[model samples]
Target: MDDSTVDRLAAELYQVSQTGKPVAHLTKRYPDITIDDAYAIQLAGRKLREADGRKGVGAKIGLTSVVMQQLFNVYEPDYGYIMDDMVVMENEPVKMSEHFVPRVEAEIAFLLKKPLEGPGISVADVLRATEGIMPCLEIIDTRYEAGTMKVEDSIADIASIGKVVLGGALTSAKEIDLRYTGLVFEKNGEIISTAAGAAVLGHPAASVAWLANKLASYGVSLRKGDLIISGSLIAACSVEAGDAVRATFDRLGSVSARFK
Candidate 1:
């Protein structure tokens, strides 16, 4: 709620991230914390990461689907900045030891070629920005005790973002009907879920549009070359050492990660 309190919580999160130890839920202790205060804590965490030499790549959207929203008891999506250091090479094995507790989700990533800012940004505007989309896997590692986080706690914890793995060839946004694009999510060589891009807020582009408009309210804009990860098409799956996860898209090829 206050600047000092926000910084303290952010520092606690930053410390846990480094030590791979989760802290207690923030909201359970600070019940009166507003969404604005949560975002302020997120911003403070961003500044702390930047100070540590991590550059902001773009942002990731979460809870984009009505199902996820209802599960979280929220009507809108939440977001967090994506840092360059959060990306892992497509062929690399993710070291689980570096994270507190991570779960993976499949997503479509939008690579913007033009700036998009708004209070009224639309899916059409997002597509017209002219770039492409790629298959991606987002690793959401919450820095809080398991099953103890509330929506505000998640917001302050950088929306539970951990690392990201991107693969697949980039395809022009105009060339594909994202709503019809489908994905087969797999874990340890078995199919886990099957979903379409429509699972992410009707169309993946719509998620990006929502992100752009939401960012505008915080005095942020989607810049050229920013890679926006639309929310997951499938539910988050817990991953452990020796496990493998992959998402194969209908036209976007596939991306995989092995945990070790």
Candidate 2:
């Protein structure tokens, strides 16, 4: 596709997201589309964001759970850049008006102390690149019309990530085996979900590793202090006005958010 074709597709996808329209048949509608070309559309959306002065500060890895992959029929995980504007404090109550459409997820976030770039980075490499990790909640909000979305459409729409909330004490990656770390999610004081670190692509660090090398193909890289939302540890929970949600981790700590 030409540059104009890429931009048109990008704008259409962003509008589809913002309008909450079902974009399932976009490929059929736009015959020039391929996952690679769809990604070109995705980048065009980010370029629009950059044109608006937003700067990417981190990355989010999705499809870490085999269950989610099985449900989606995708063998590989998808990723999206997290701009600085998306990061928020967990202690603060999240205003409902801040989002168009949203859902919350429990995750362990890492702030790298060194750059992570890869064509062949390993889980061990991710652990070594660690500065510290913390508990977090990522808000995945979609703007697709009809509210239905495909994985590629979501990836093109910044993985449907709207905001991320981080808190709890930070711990060194060496302090604990993230694979064995456990967490239980609660909403209004009731346990709603449970997960172990191993659930995320077998280990949370591997998600970051996968992201590093994935972005390397485009010449993008992760830097020190980049806030990576490793992947959801618990099944995502629906949020509505006045609902309170929290996730307590086995070692990392706890983070929470309240709608409205």
Candidate 3:
């Protein structure tokens, strides 16, 4: 797509997000669009948010699991920026009326203490960067109309990220075997899904390393104090109004949210 078209699509997506109105899939209308173009659109949307005073807090990785890859028919993971306004406190109520097609997933979040810019970042490097890790729940919402989105479309929609809730348990990464860390998601007192940190591209830290390397290609770097939410441990579950969602991690405690 041309620059003008990319800008127009980015504006349309931003408008859709603000209005809670769904739009047609960009890939469905522009089949020739490439992943690079999709990322450009994402950046455009990020620029809009920044201009509107929504600071970039961190980033979220998507499609990191084999299950998600197969479901989307994509072989690699994608990522998106996380804005300050997207952070919700644990046990807080998220107004469903403010989102479109919202869903939730359980994951781990990395709070960085040092800058990480990578062409070849390793999981060990990610852990060594210091700070701590927290169990997290990512709320995903898409501006694209359901059932018509492609990988490119998802990328342009900022990987469909909406909000995030961070758990209170903050532990050093060096203290735990994150690969074996386990998670269980519950909705209204019923166990809905279960997974382990290994589900996230083999290890949760590996996902952060991947993000560091991937962002380097776009001239971006993970900075100190940045809160990076690694890929989901389990598949996302659809959420509705009046629902209570909770995720319990074996050693990381639990985080919860109420939809209203």
Candidate 4:
């Protein structure tokens, strides 16, 4: 697709997101759209938000887990930009009505102490650059119709990121083995999912490394102080209004949010 067409599609998707209304699959309408074109649409959408004063804070890695990849029928990971306004505090009330179709997942969030730019970034390099890790809840809201979205559609939709809740605890990467870190996800006081950090691409740090390298392909770099949310450790669960969600990590403590 050409730049004008990409811009128009991006604006359409962004309008759908803002209005909490679902739209038809972009790939179905534009069968010739490539992954690169989808990413360009995503960037164009980000520019739209940036023009409205939303600053990019960091990035989020998606589909790093086999479960999610299988769910999405995709083989590789994808990423999306994180805007500052998308963040919510732990235990804050989230307005569920603001989303079209929102789901929640448990994750480990990394706060960078040094910039990471990679063509050859490794797990060790990610650890060395780390500031700390915190438990987080990623709320994913899709703007596309159900079962109609392809990988390219997801990339264009900014990985369906809606909101993020960061936990209060921040533990150094060297202090614990992230691969072995366990998480118990609870909704309305009952356990709904449980997983280990290794569920995210063998190790949460590995996901960050993957993201750094992936972003490099687009001429982007992970900057210092970026809050990177590694792929979810557990499968995402559907959420509704009046629901209370929580995720307890073995070492990183817990994070919670209430939807209303």
Candidate 5:
């Protein structure tokens, strides 16, 4: 897509975000939209938000799991920026009124202590740069109406990420094996799903490594202090007002979020 077209689409997304009214799927309207066009539109939207005062803290990776890949019909993972405004304190109530269609997923978050610049970044490099790992809940909110939202539509809508809730104590990756880490997802005090860290591209750190290399192609690097949520360990569950969600990770503690 052209610059003007990208800007127009970004503006539409911005408007929808403010009004909580989703628009039609982008891929449906723009059948020829490519991954590059989608990222360009996402970047344009990020610029618009930054101009309005939101700061980019880090990025979120999605679709690293085979289930998520099949659900989205995308063969590879996608990444999106995490704005400072998108963070909610652990145990805080997420304002459901502010989101269009929110769903929650469990993930392992990586807080980088050193910059990772890469064309060939590996999981070992990611582990070495890690500051700590925290159990997290990623709220997925898509600005497009349900149906036929391909990877293109998702990437354009910031990988459908809404908000993040971080909890648990920070622990070094060297102290534990992420691939063997287990997670239990609870909704309203009932267990809804369970998964192991290996569910995410055989290991969560591998997902972060993938993001670093992916960003390197665009001349971007994962900088020190940046937080990256390695893709979801379990499938995302829909959330509504009065709902309570928590994710308990073995060796990583737990994080919770309430919808109100």
Candidate 6:
């Protein structure tokens, strides 16, 4: 695709994301479309990047949940960038108008004290590189209308990231057996589901390792202070207005967010 072709698709994508309209994935129409091609179009829709206007602090994992795998019909997870502006304190209410068809998921977030870059990164590397871990809520909304997305289309849509909420700070990554750290998700005082730090590709840190290597392929690197959201422990729930969501980890405390 030419520069104009990429830009045109991106612009259309951004319009729908910001306006809460929907779009169909071009790949579904043209199965021959490569992920690279899809990215060109999706990045062209860079409305979120423009709105936040902050440096990319980290990345988030998508399609990691078994439920999402079933929903999206893919086994591997996709990724998106997280900006400084998207980071907010947990337990606060977010306006509903901010996202287009937004949904929520529970995750374990890690603040990296050291950088991890690699063609061959390991799980131990992720554990040693972290400053600490915390509970996080991931907000997912599409840039296009409800449509099937190719890898590149999702990437260009900035990995379909909408917003993030962080809470329940831990003293250190080593404080708990992060891989087995288990918890339940509750909404409005009812137990909705469960997830463990282990559910995230074995450990949340491993997700960071995956992010680091994945970004390196595109000439990006993980930097110090990057708040990496490993992957969802539980399923992505269809969020509605007035819903109060919280995740309570076994050893760690709880983090909550409300939609308004």
- The per-model lDDT (C-alpha) reads 0.91, 0.82, 0.91, 0.91, 0.93, 0.76
Scored by lDDT, model 2 comes in at: 0.82
For residues 12-120, write the lDDT of model 2, one tens digit per residue.
7656535645354454456555567767777898887788798988889888898888776788888888887788887677876766667889999988989988889
Which candidate should be chosen as best, given lDDT against the real structure?
A: 5
| lDDT of model 2 at position 136 | 90
Per-residue lDDT of 2-118 in model 3, one digit per residue for the tens?
899989999999998668788999988898999999999999999999999999999999999887888889888999999999999886789887798899999999999999999
Q: What is the TM-score of each candidate against the true structure?
A: 0.97, 0.91, 0.97, 0.96, 0.97, 0.87
By summed lDDT, the worst window of 10 consecutive residues in model 5 runs over 65-74
Model 6: CA > 4 A from native: 17-20, 28-30, 41-52, 65-75, 147-152
lDDT for position 250 in model 3: 83
Clashes of each: 0, 9, 0, 0, 0, 5
Sequence-dependent TM-score of model 4: 0.96
The ten-residue window of minimal lDDT in model 1 covers 142-151
TM-score of 5: 0.97
Clashing pairs in 4: none
lDDT of 4 at 55: 94
For residue 52, model 1's alpha carbon misses the true position, in angstroms, by 1.3
Q: Per-residue lDDT for 1-260 in model 6, tens only?
A: 77877777777666664576667775666567666676566445544456556567887887665666676666667777787777777756877877767877888888889888875777788888888888888887776656566566666677778889888576577768887888899988899998677787777777777777777777767888888888888767777899888888876677888999
lDDT value, candidate 3, whole model = 0.91
Tell me the tens digit of each residue's lDDT in model 1 across 1-260: 77999999999998996687788898888989988999999999999999999899989999998988888899999999999999999989999888878899999998999999998999999999958889999999888887767789889988989999999589887878999998999999999999999999999999999988998898989999898999999989999999999899988999999999
Q: Candidate 1, overall lDDT?
A: 0.91
User: Which stretches of candidate 4 lie above 4 Å from their native place?
Assistant: 71-73
TM-score of 1: 0.97
Candidate 3 worst ten-residue window by lDDT: 142-151
